[model samples]
Target: MCPPNCLHAVCEKATRRGLLKSGFTLGIAAMAGAGSLAGGARPASAATDTGPLSFSKITDMSHTLYEGFPTFSGERWFEMERPVTWEKDRVNLNRWTLMEHTGTHIDAPLHFSEDGNSVDLIPVADLLCPLAIIDIRAKAAADADAYLTPDDIAAWEAQHGEIPEGACVAMNSGWAAHLKTEKYTGLDAEGKNHTPGFHHEAARFLIEERSVRGIAVDTLSLDRGLASGEFPVHYDWLGSGRWGVECIASMDEIAPSGAYVFVGAPKVAGGSGGPSRIVALH
Candidate 1:
């Protein structure tokens, strides 16, 4: 069920008190135990033996994929079975199969545009960039179909300064907290799925005006759930040679801006989309 003052969807106003009082902020510390996806590789300052490079906390923004996690209806869900066990084969081995876009994943340009680059073609440098988060969860809680508009982007900018060119933008709906509920997929009485996403104008503004490198969301698709068959967000971003990340988890842990994210996904030949392991450093 939705929280008090939130109807079938979430509420439009979220206060720090409300977020804490509702227990939405609990257990989040568990997501921040790791640091530095770059691993043992240190910056040049430390390489010179002057001193150790300053370290930052790492927060994993990817969801753990497992057998039978919720998937878009009609799409293949993940499945795994143990092929070998310690008692039988002297080792533990398991095999799993899933669609490319399943769970936390990236949608390469080829996923939507015929002329766009495939997963293997996306440059390594483009996958990592400045992170800017646009929080519209409060508004989305009031209307499941709500999307970010130009004004919304401006509002975020007013507080965080301009969203830099080539930066990665994240649309944090606070919906990840609802992943265990039916509200994650948001099926209404009439069987329509209503969820938050990027409005067409907002998408265009981000891509054409702001020159953003990519966008991520906490929902199933960058387009709203009720977009029916039209994927405006995908067409706008991927069509323009930009990439997108979907089903990103734990975005609420990061600040609205000034963070860096690394999008690491297997490079599948001729693939349109693939599973990704995304992380943020703050």
Candidate 2:
């Protein structure tokens, strides 16, 4: 069963209590592990005002990195000493290497789009969008080789509602939970990853039928980890001017099925995909 504290389908691992000063950066709050909403938070009630005037802020879905966390291959690590210190009335800050996709992040067209938009090329407005999350955790748990099909999505719509056009259609397959354990990622005996992904039909349905802005997932890649040589899914999705969002976390808590989704990715000068922070507001 899902945990009660979970909002947006994410499970809260821990929580802290404190009064936050105004103008604290999210990075700072995240580093301090204070006052932020726990993971898997529910959306505000319909009667409640969710606008700026209403809630101060909900849970931040992004994950942080230091030690004792899931590192993407060799992309993330810490040095012997701290990188920043407010030492005796003076602060010394240092620069360290950060991979394009570390912690909680989104991928750009350049991630898979050969001749498509780079991290900097995508419009800021385009970063924020309406969302549609289709949960397939149960099916995925039953079969690691499971895939998202139009039929499955159609079944969801039979209950939830239709997938809107130009919206960010996110699939919360509950894969992030598997990040800590080998069983979560469902990696095979041969080191091959076995995870849930969208079928070509589902991708086509979103790209053509739903006219989606893009597709996002809580996994490493949008395509099924064990593709049998053919990558029609990638070729079709990116080739059709649509993009993909990967390595995302904390999507399950979102309710209303359709809400505005946003991304704050670094616009590296002449960069490729780079890293991004994703947000969702109903």
Candidate 3:
């Protein structure tokens, strides 16, 4: 048993281990910016090193999972069944059925690359990093198929300083508010979708130039809803051995540049994608 005075530390240790079992790492929530928490939380060798930041509130950046939630074309929706209700079995056990890519989730490299790492194999450092929020909501509102260009990223960097190498760059398309409506998907008469996403140039710049950990978006897919032919964005990014986070929620609540994002997903051995709980601490 932990000593009374060691309760806090013990709890933190337990929490960290539990997260690892769940396919997450407390390092994602604890450490931010361009650093890595690969092996585990900071070692005892660096216990006293408080490089930057002190205290802050953690914000939930994921969506609520429920039956009939939105889904991409040809993907299964979410479902929940309480097979063992408390009244019947003196316990409450739930059985869930949903697509790996449903709701807010991380698209591991395997989603696009034939021999890439699966969700469980993605390094902890990649899921946890400083967030670069590019606000192009106004442009998206005017044009449903708006693309976040390199110029937009440059403008954001001009104000927030250069995006740190290995950070997670997220597109703030202001689409979360419309999730309850058909407009969130923005399907057109020809059955084509019109959603905002990063331009090919922007993705290339973030990957090749910035050396970012990955890209994220608050929409159905990382690529625009109306992307024609092959998913060039996915092919370009994930195919390059990186990952993607999609359907992120609550971008408006966090700061544009300083927050740290934590992505928690199930450790499905070879899952190409999976349901995730993403959050940010500012």
Candidate 4:
């Protein structure tokens, strides 16, 4: 069920066909008036006096978790046990066992920083923010070890203007297409995974220059898989008191800019990280 006065409520009530046909525009002021509703501020492209902003589409950017889903450790991280069945117990119930960082998940600052915010300690406002997607699909396709570099950030800004303040910058390497295949993990004979991620410099640039709320990626880890044990990007980004999302699905569906992302991170006390239901509206 949608929360009272929440943006999900508006999405739930409006049919996609109806929204398209009527060219419905959601009022930013209305959303802001809802107190704790998502998208506390409007995008820079949208003027304060513009009255309303129209979002033509909504996309779910999270991947489903199952027993066999890929994990950084090359071991299964999710399992389900049916404890009760309707035919036998008159009700269906199941027990789930999973790791905190399984599937589409958020990496709270505490994941790396000793004195950082835990999953439950993260502020509500930071969970919802503007989305900036950096496309390195071509590069990643040719070189699995490719990472989002500072040049990529500059190129994206050259085309789409500067990344908005407090935005969630995501790297779209088109890696989600490899899910369910060994290619997704890209493990070699040495057991090192070859995947796309963010370069430390790019992560630092976003934090020091753009003041972004977080970073996200379509790959398993924030640093290039070849980085081995040195997680430079993770230490620099999360240790700096910022959050991140990993294994994000459908990043290709969202625009490079002008989209808002809602990261529904689990509020597990003292948790380093947890699975999240991430959605985008544009």
Candidate 5:
């Protein structure tokens, strides 16, 4: 007989393997496409006449998942058990029990809209796009309930050129610095989560005015924590058939612009969303 929750264990392994395979395939396809456009077959290591597409640095933007990672409900949402021990079974295997939205995760449109796309249904092309980091660290340092407003976006564009269409606009609130701490959630005396996120107007601007593929944040939700259970950003953005990433890490390493992001969202069939491995290249 199989152990309890064995299906979840299998699914976890499959998800990891699938992500790796997909990345590998995509990389090869991109290289081949570049070579084809160059008018001749070129070795994978050879640079194109216009110069090879390369990154000077790669930064991981996904936070490590652990049993104690904070969740929206203020409860422990991840657990792990070593079902196969190295000393006893000559191998190491763990069974993880986690909520789809735990840790650093993607929020599919279906998370808010019934007729929206699920994680697996999101277009592969949308997962890879330019990254635009909107720095709100100073504001958030003063007010934990600070959020990305349309004015902030305008200011960012004024300095760093207009945000590229189909880019992922991320909020660098410096919240990742408070990970695994009580300050991360900033629970008030009344049990309200005081974290930085996207303002409703900002969400509307990105969705209606800009052609962004999605939004990301270094916090727990797309809406400011003080929204008092009113997730306007979440509903507005996701309802428009776009996705969002939350709990991102290492925002400090990525520049405000001139970087591309790869969102390694899981391919879980019918899943509303799942923990994702997000990386940035610059």
Candidate 6:
């Protein structure tokens, strides 16, 4: 009942959407960085404009119902059934008991710092902005404790141009591929995790130099889980009162660099960083 060309377009759109939500990337990867965001971020007050972004093909960077995946509680759990619901006296309610850091949740400043901003306190304007994806998968495959150094970002800039201020600096480490298994965590027998994260210098650049609105990643924490020496990344970003997006599951789907509208938010009341969705425009 549809035009032939339109049908093909629909099929392609469906495929892209599946690939995005399924957390599969068909491109190179990058690493996370520090952030001095939130001071003077450009506000994307309007998101209704259309462009080459293929909103129909938008991807959900949050985790799905996968068991043994990391959560804030330092444990792994996910939904087992489709309709996680309970009904009583015809009062049917739709509900899902997800962890605060489940899916694509933001890390409010309060998440780490003793006196940091909460999800509700974040300005609605800061939540949306252009996105920057930095790939560091190659380094990660070699060293588990590999961090995204400023030199790496500099190299990326040499090709992609200087990372514009107010852009959401994200990383693609290819770790999403291993999320289903323990190795994806890159945890060693010593119970220490060895994964790619923000390099101290890279963190400083994103925060003090480029002034990105926020830092996002497809990993457990902005800093590698194995970090214990000084914690430079956390010390810098949190000290600056910038938020972090953690446990993100995808990045390869987005354009290398472009104007994207961020739509992720929290529960407002009892939320630290709830599962949220993000979309990019060409």
Total backbone collisions for each predicted model: 2, 15, 0, 0, 0, 8
RMSD, candidate 6, Å: 8.2
Query: Candidate 6's residue-wise lDDT over 1-282, tens digit each?
Result: 565489569857867678544533321111112122443433322222321233334556666645545642347544544343345344333445566666556877666676667777766656665677888889888877777788888887898887765567887888778776676566666666777789878888777777576788777778876435456777677656677787666577776676464656765763456666654543
Best-performing candidate as measured by TM-score: 4
lDDT of 4 by residue, 33-100 (tens): 23221122332232233446567777899999888889866788888999899899988779989889
* Candidate 2, lDDT over the whole model: 0.60
For model 5, how does the per-residue alpha-carbon lDDT over 46-85 read when each residue is reduced to its tens digit?
Answer: 2222233355555789988988898756788899999899
The TM-scores, one per candidate, come to 0.79, 0.71, 0.82, 0.86, 0.82, 0.72
**TM-score of candidate 4 on Cα atoms, chains taken together:** 0.86
Tens digits of lDDT, candidate 1, 179-269: 7788888876767788898888988887656657688999888898943878888887788777899899988789888676779977989
Q: Residue 250 CA error for candidate 2 (Å)?
A: 2.2
Model 6 reaches what TM-score against the true structure? 0.72
Residue 254 local lDDT, model 4: 74
All candidates: CA RMSD (Å): 11.9, 10.7, 7.4, 4.7, 9.1, 8.2
Give a tens-digit lDDT track for model 3, residues 1-282: 555559567747856776424433233224433343221222111212334433245678899877877764534588888999989998777999887888888998889888887888876656666778999999999998999899999999899998865677999999988888888888767778888988888888776677576789999888888437558788888877777898899999888987777788668999998989897866
- Displacement of the residue 4 alpha carbon in candidate 2, Å: 32
In what order do the candidates fall by lDDT, top score first?
4, 5, 3, 1, 6, 2
The local distance difference test score of each candidate is 0.74, 0.60, 0.76, 0.81, 0.80, 0.64
The sequence of per-residue lDDT tens digits that candidate 2 reaches over residues 207-260 is 656646668877766777643546566677766555567767777777736456
Q: Pick the winner on TM-score between candidates 2 and 4.
A: 4
Backbone collision tally, model 2: 15
* Candidate 3 residue pairs that clash: none
Off by over 4 Å in 4: 1-13, 20-53
